[model samples]
Target: MTDLAGHEGAWREFRAALASPRMHHAWMLTGLKGLGKGQFARAAAAELVAEPGIPQPPAEAHPDILIPEHPPENKDEAKKREDGGEYRRKRAIPIEEIRTLIQRLHTRPTLGSRRAVIIDPADDLERNAANALLKALEEPPAGTYFLLVTHRPGRLLPTIRSRCRVLRFNPLDHAAMERILRESAPQAEAAARAAAIAAAEGSPGAALDFVDQDLGRLHQVMLRLIAEGDEHFALRGELAEEIGTRPDRERQQAAVDLARAVVAAELGRGDARRNQAVIQVHGDLVRLSGQLPTYNFDPALVVMEIGALLASLAMPREAA
Candidate 1:
């Protein structure tokens, strides 16, 4: 079971609501991505579908619950057909999927007093699919509960948002982030863990993703590049080339993210001269990252360009 970590307050509130006489039929778990919103919804649903006085069943064992999310595009149709016509996951949860859930909910519960449905990210629902869900929320079947997880609740229909109870989740604090890092990356050295946590900026999910990376070393390199100004083009170019050559997208993205964090830290240190340069570099990195897939830009050239910009910022006026 994934620990809720910094979400104790939200959990306590939910438990209290469950114990109340007038329990809500639907709830929207609103939080930034990677804050464990999906895990909380699944755990809560398990308890909801369990028989009274019985321990909550595991997610897989709970027959009266359904957790649906957008599937990968590469889902195997033959495998799905072989599995007795089970719904093949798709890139988006279409109206067809919601209709299927609606049809299932209309029937009596198979395992317990209630049926529970959890949508890990309701934001992925298309217009028609969202409307289909709205009907269910408007007139929910008896003994049915809906848990909708959304990073951006504002994008949901106003009527849907109005009908559901909203549970807000905040980002984790430093202590909570450190604890999560220790649990998730026990094999990581202390310095690596600390660097990841600092780079995470109070997000455990971010910290966990960075645990295996040598962010501590990378951070120092970034600082050294900035400190060296534009004097050593060779060193800066070499560092950028290394960053650009990583094969895995996630690793490369994480490295870029950590580089931004280092700049943010530099900005925080009250250095006025480099503020404009830092901001420009950060903006350029973000723009380049967004366009990398669509434009097929070479990552090595991208990094090198960023390095040149940084170096030029430190050039003396006479040299300029």
Candidate 2:
């Protein structure tokens, strides 16, 4: 019933650790994005906090579990009208919140002796917040458990990694990704579903996000552009005309994302020249994607440049 198709190994390893007489107080569920590390951490935390013979409560209502994420800057205000109905979530988890959670962790658990603190994507923690967390991890309470989920464990303090048992989650296989799509988006046409899975690169979350953005059509366009012997210049112009002409931020991002996916698909082949070109192009695209908000640049112009770059990369060198 649980969606852990590609992670049976991790599950077995966790279960083995649980069966041991001495249980670790801190666990780091670390892996690539969209591999369900947060989900697994929450499930384990719930199970850990549940009383004997009773099912774990929903994460939102679990008394023994505390999830401290990024709260809005203005804690009192529900939201600003112009910024939408709810206050925008802060960019980082503040130190005050982590301190509060640590204080609670040291106290006796209301539900039982066991308690859990789940920090999803712990990478978002600020320096002070991370240090606060590190202090708790250094000497956690007797019955407390810290479940930290991070897409990039390398970013965390080395001391924090040393204090926890690391569990790595790998990307799902193609078959498992397709199965998940079939269940989650059964209404999608067969071709669309296939495109979504291809774009996902074995991550169901990526597939869902792609399909939601209607990127299947863009995928087809990118595939044709990259096909062998294709005329890259003309294809680039056409793609720029189609995607770059729009000034919308979302559209521009989707166009760059599609192009990056193509580059990723073509990377690391035996062709050294092609690898270098795609890598450079992909890097520029990534940087541009990040800088879009800061400057008032024309989306079409940026994408056309990207197209031209890809074309140059695809061109065959002059015959020897």
Best by lDDT: 2
> Highest TM-score: which candidate?
2
- Report every candidate's CA lDDT: 0.74, 0.75
Model 1: per-residue Cα lDDT over 181-293, one tens digit each: 78888888888888887877666776777766555665666666766775747767666655656435555566666666666665544355556666777777666544443
Residues forming the 10-long window of minimal summed lDDT in candidate 2 = 311-320
| Model 2 TM-score on a 0 to 1 scale | 0.80
Error of 2 at 241 (Å): 7.8
Which residue segments of model 2 deviate by more than 4 Å? Answer: 1-3, 73-77, 80-85, 224-259, 279-312, 315-320
In model 2, the clashing pairs are none
Candidate 2 local Cα displacement, residue 231, angstroms: 11
